[model samples]
Target: MAAPAHTFTHDGIAFGGDYNPEQWHPSVWEEDVALMREAGVDLVAINIFGWAAVEPRSGEFTFASLDRVIELLHAAGIRVNLGTGTASPPAWLTLAHPEILPIAEDGTTRYPGGRQAWCPSSPAFRTAALSLVRAVAERFGSHPAVALWHVSNELGCHNALCYCDQSAAAFRRWLRARYNSIDALNAAWGTAFWSQTYSDWDEILPPRAALSARNPGQALDFHRFSSDELLDYYRAEAAVIRDLSDVPVTTNFMVAAHIENMDYWQWAGEMDVVANDHYLDYRLGDPRTELSFAADLSRGLALGSPWLLMEHSTGAVNWQPINFAKSPGQMLRNSLTHVARGADAVCFFQWRASLQGSEKFHSAMLPHAGTDSELWREVVELGAILSKLDEVAGSRVVADIALVFSWESWWAADAESRPSTAIGYLDQVHAVYAAFAALHMTMDVVAPGADLSEYKLVVVPGLHLVRNEEAAIINDWIADGGTALVTFFSGIVDENDRVWAGGYTGPFRDALGVAVEEFAPLAPDSRVSLDSGATGTKWSERMRVTTAEVVDAFADGPAAGSPAITRNRWGSGNAWYLSTLLEPEEYRSLALQLAAEAGVDSPVRVSGDAEGAVEVVRRRGDLASYVFAINHSNTSVQLQVSGTELITGDNNAGHNTAGHNTAGDNTVATVEVPPGAVRIIREESAS
Candidate 1:
């Protein structure tokens, strides 16, 4: 695969945000360019929503505005992440071809007023969209300012699952390719239960609105087909770019809390460089933990390589029901945290805040207040800070633990007929990840069936759907001495959405040495006590012991006196099973106990008059190693290390936050980390 576009002049972290000069007049363009220079902005994305602008009429094309914007940025030494402008369709095309509009699951047409309103299977839309892509690529493919080819802006964000007739035809074609024949598809879909058997390909349809609960097998396949369709569309756009340009190609992946539409692992191999757009979703509290999880996940999609943060927010975002602006240094803290986890570039959703449109109130690098605001000051300071860590680019994050993240599990667990409405796959993953975060442990987020050989410890939480081979790999790894933590609702089904037959914990029963007799999903806001003196919520299971030792049992609830937690000595290593979701603190305590057994350790520790938490992560390169200490609290803390501090540019410019201490590579080197400050240390081997 090709490397990511590294176009900044100083060889430092790439900086800047989405820039739309067409939204303003040429008079404002000069000022915007000057401000970009003043803030040290080196990268800016243009023509992201250029579908309507570039091709205003069906066959008519205009490059006057786009050409001028690129010329201005190029003149100012800013490299471009150019968009193909197929993000959304223009009003004329949709009016001319109404069949291209997407249909909701409830059989409603998603109009073209919003972005991403076209159906993925519509040939009319694809032809028009691909034509626009070709026009953009042909015009600017060899342009000096163009550093990267952005295919489409956030594909599948608005229309992943469409129930139109075209989608049904496309679904049948995809099914034929996967299952090969009608008999094979029937076996996989388990159609006999509801008299839903298909005699031929044409008989099958996209799982549309139903009288009762939809078929799990059908629903699961539709989700898979939807993700595949979007990936296929992206591949087509990428093909156009590759034929015309050598610039690395990428489209921003919505790998955030609200999106689970795309199985990004399948799409990773197709990208030249993986990029992601992330925003703070207040629905999931503790923005710090949520931010780390998202950044780490983006890295995971890149296969642990350095990735670009294509979109974040400077302050409040406009989409959320209750948007909250970042408090004080939060903007800086959020940017650095992404860097701490291995983001080589930091960019936000926009450069200038919009004056009109759905995103009008969305914060940007340059707010509506222009350069006079404190937001602009913070943006400039962040730009300077990023420039100081030039050498930190291209380094890989260090991790010893692996967390299995499966989109299949997410799809299956979230369907309508699950045991509990509260057993959310992402929620469970976040809850378990928060446990690791509480212990200040950095972990690798891996997909199902990933090699566990490199990791000392593996964490599997809420893995509701596991293929036979995936289960076998984990079983083999554990028997070969890899420690693991497998939680509830895991190993329940195979690739076909069919049960594993023997017990609740299906293919994992042998490795886990425990049998889940039945699922006992609890009521909402419910609680159950465990023998370990910890309270559990969300779910509990009736289980029996085989070779596994019962570590904790239920004290009350449906499965009273049953095992709540189990530990099995499988071969040379250990496998622990959690039957219920424990409170955050208790979960972290148990995770630490397992970590101690696995010999996982972090060199850094934090304790002081600190008011908030400090996230510690390290990146390793052949020539140098660096530690990132990000303080997210209210009071200052001390980071003692023997290295050169990048921000202050001293031999060891440690902090005096804990009263006072010298900063040196030898003894007495203490760096005081002010609350909500970021410190990067280039370490010495001798220390």
Candidate 2:
């Protein structure tokens, strides 16, 4: 068999999670280790929030406890992912340096009651954080068991806009670097309209609720500034660790996290690898939506390279309004989903449940009673399965489809009201994603400026803030035979949120072969059917088709029978224009037609029954490939497995027919997969 492209070769997928020995006694360490061994846990992320213990005073530090924990784990033959412990500042640091406390939007200083309360622009916080990181690195940089360096916990503040004096000053500097001149800034911000032009750097302030009616340009810049400030803090801490050690460093970013602009593309460059926390309410059916987007984003961050699954709740999250427990096979399936989607390792928010504090009710390997529970058994089983498939670890799966996910576009489009409030930036992106998901088409969600040569089809959901260079790049790709999907509300603004005055889509008008004259935001209950004979709801954009053919049209409203969806042919490529919010069914139908045009094949042959309840991911090599089918439903479903089951080692289950290869082939072999069950098939060489 051909060597797998992306697989976990080291015993199995790394199992174990965030371990906080500081919260427990030394006597409890032995028991925790034993429980970990029982659960086949080989890796432990240690010292995530142990800053208080690591640094007791300003200059004085203590590494004795941490040293002992690392030594013990190493002795037990377990790998350690050492954390810098800078996420939550110690009480003393906060009390001594009052600037560390972030200033809320109302200009009120927030007390340090919760973590992530530190002001990113605070010099005292930076100095103290860098000192502790340097100390940790100096002590354990070369530890034998150390595998990676985790920078901080989550790296997001509940209240993001810090209107403090320090933040305000930093925002001015950031704006200066971006705009260069006050006149340029004024022109870009259109401050002449509101008479809010700035005379000096000090006159500028952090955009807050108190100053709601400020210039859109200034407010947008403040958002970017705040994000950059926090990113600087992350970089500062990362630099400290890198100065002492060569181990890869990363901070866990929340999926769909909208705090400080955190452009993953820029942030991914600073760290050796990218990791993200995955927390979705199963009730919302958003796990498939969020995780798929997140996995693709992480993969895109490293240019299709594998990423770490840093933090996930094993069972229930206490923070949500209603804590729902993962069903019997749900946790295992979720972990495998991460691996199938390009995760290098699988770890959770916690290894052991906390006895006291806010996370006491959170689920973990060892429950609050300190006994081995179902969650522990599931963790062990997953570890064992990973061990058996160790050869598949560390391999990468190449994607032929790329969906454009831009932070700049999201920021700019949402900054001002143009089309409709119901059609949010994320919602539009997710609509395209849901379409792909329904068709069982695997795609990579990427940022702007990502390489377009690898993907045959490129979907830009909301390219609202298309820069001239980026637009040229897209046009070139389309001219070179790439199928481009551009949606409504796109090309409305430039990098500075300035409307592309000449036309709606700016430079993309010629590439799309169409011009949008006006936007029509439909009512919530509005309905429209396509001329291609499909129906949808919510909103639609009215456009004058310059050269494009109307593939679908609006069925109702003032613009009824108008072009709701258009197709334009440029060079040997095709451009699809969606002029409205499509219902789920309409989206799937249109997606199927687009996929066909792009020459992308669906992995799942049978559909409708398993529509959104299952997801398919394929990792292809030159000759062979592996297909993973995941059932995200709450009930068991039948899957026709033409290839042999990779995990079962049972080729007899599926039928063997003439003219078929050794991997097992059948016209139709119905395999009943339980809810949350993941099945992997090793496809035979097509050659």
Candidate 3:
């Protein structure tokens, strides 16, 4: 496959963050550029939120100040990812065209003080946004400093859904285009039960309250429409950029977990390169795992291409409650974690700390404490380290396993009504991914309908919504000697959130040799013991075994002594069905067992006695394999490997002790990984 255009410059990884010079004084621009060059910054994202400063009045354009900032950075040998500055429109446009403002689900008009306040489907909004995009592209298409065309800042981060009359009209048009006729729509929506049938397209409205229960099909379609509406806005801007400039155009994507509103699997096709903005959710006990989840999904969307880490927090963020700060060396570790997962670039949210704004408390490269601060010193050190490891860029992560993920399933699973309110779609995905991570195994988090011929083991976790075509694809792969793991709550609904006719598990019932008759969601704080000495919690299904071998049975519960885990031989391979949420250790063991059955193993293993968590990821280059060992626990751990330590520039020999050898002929070596530390080792032998 061909690589995306304008992803990098000078054959090195882009190492700078967002640069908003318009927020600072003119005198600060020179110093900012100098500081950037001093820190080995080669690319800077500028004008991300400069709409008010660029065009103060309607139909007016001014680029003098931004031109100076671009020129200064260009003279300093830095390339630019120039933004269209359409994220937050000027007050004049919002005040003149109030219809452009988005309406909340509660029927309140969102004001202009906040960003992303424009309704996506409003004709006035689209007209003004596309106009600004054209002007920006025409002005900077051929600028010497411009290397990338940033379409918009974090599309649909807020206000992804609008229930205004304008959006309602757009939704109706979208529904008509999809279903074609009212009869077909009524059948798909099951409107006869509630007397909500529509004879005309105009009768259909955006999903709203005042009903006992909103139509699940209507809500699902609205979610899809909202995603498409935002995508259309992006495509309109990308069209202008593509016509005016050869530079690659992209918009940074938000978290993958909350992408039920916008299906990125469809949106990624329109972009030149994939870029993502991820912030650590401090509320989670372990945020690094969430980081891996996001990065893996980002890389999957890139389809093995190198993606850009557009924006991340250097330390504390201003948005989250409590705004926890990073400990020593944690920032560097977090950035490298993304790199290990396949990010070609590592950049933060801003270059300098804001003096007066909502994000003033947010940490940046140059923090509020200035150059003498520890964060600034660590930032410089990370930059210097990244300068020497350019080989890590453009390398793809090779995994023996893949987990199926779907935005459609996520949307339908999280509807207002379901088998159980506690069954979260992404939560189950994260649980399975984390289980594999705990076993030091690497995996590709991919779409459910993605091609599965390359992987040995494919895992589908809690996919409540499954389509017939998707089921056929998986069944075909399994018949072709591929192993699969389908968990509880899967194969329950089709694309329209309608359950299959035969029973739950849909097409998978035959493949797994099991049928789910009823759901048995446990009460809060309840648990069921498994025959494998593990506990199950949250939810369980009443499953009956047919031809499959029961792997584990419930020890005690309403469905005691029943099949909790079963394996069925189908064609040349086997399919496993998990009927309950297993404990973390049991889940890891079972996942590893299935992986072993599929002839897959970890690339690296911990030897001797290690008392902490050591996560390993391997990325393959043309010449060597880069093995990244990250210690997530507070205690130090020892790892045995054969590689040249890239960070310390040490070419160690095989079977040597940590920090004690200099030869490169040994087949194994040991390294003492510090607490909360990261080590990248370049293997002596090629992968």
Candidate 2, 264-368: lDDT as tens digits: 666666666667778765545465566677677777776676777887877898877789888888787788878888887888878889989989999987776
Residues 1-687 of candidate 1 have per-residue lDDT tens digits of 334333223266899889877688778988888999999899898899988889999988899988988998999999999999999999999999999999998899899788988999999999999898998899999999998888889999989889999999999999999999899988998989978888989998888898999899999999999999999999899888888888888889998888988999888877877788889888876666888998998899888888899999999999888999988788988999999898988999899888999999999999999888899999999999998988989889998999999988999999888888876998789988888876668889999999889989999998999988998899899999989999999999999899989888888898899999999989989999998789999999998999999999999999999999899999998999999999988998888888998988654555566622788888887788888888877788776565788987877464332323333334444667777788888887522
Relative to the true structure, how large is the alpha-carbon lDDT of every model? 0.87, 0.76, 0.84
Cα RMSD of predicted structure 2: 3.9
What TM-score, to 2 decimals, does candidate 2 have? 0.93
Each candidate structure's TM-score, on Cα atoms with residue i matched to residue i, is: 0.96, 0.93, 0.96
**Best lDDT among the predictions, by candidate number:** 1
Candidate 3 segments exceeding 4 Å error: 1-10, 608-612, 653-655, 658-667
- In angstroms, the error of model 2 at 269 is 1.2
User: Model 1, residue 386: displacement in angstroms?
Assistant: 0.6
The runs of at least 3 residues in candidate 2 whose Cα sits more than 4 Å from the true structure, single-residue gaps closed, are: 1-12, 157-160, 257-260, 282-285, 369-372, 416-418, 604-608, 621-624, 634-644, 651-675
Alpha-carbon error at 601 in model 1, in Å?
Answer: 1.3
lDDT of 1 at 1: 33
Model 3 over residues 1-687: C-alpha lDDT tens digits?
Answer: 234544444366679999988888899999999999889898899988988888878789999998899999999999999998888878899989999898887788899887888888989978887888888888889998998888889988887999999999999899889989999999899998778887888888888775476899999999999999999898889888878998888899986454457888888877788889998887765677888889988998888677899999889999877999998988988888889888888899889999988899999999989999999999999899888779888888988898888888888988887777765887788888888887788889788678988899999998888888888888888888999999988999888788886767997888889988888888757899988788998888777888899999989886787889999998988999998887787888898899789998777656433432677889988888888888766777666677787887777823466433234653545776778777788887866
Clashing pairs in 3: 653-663, 654-666, 655-668
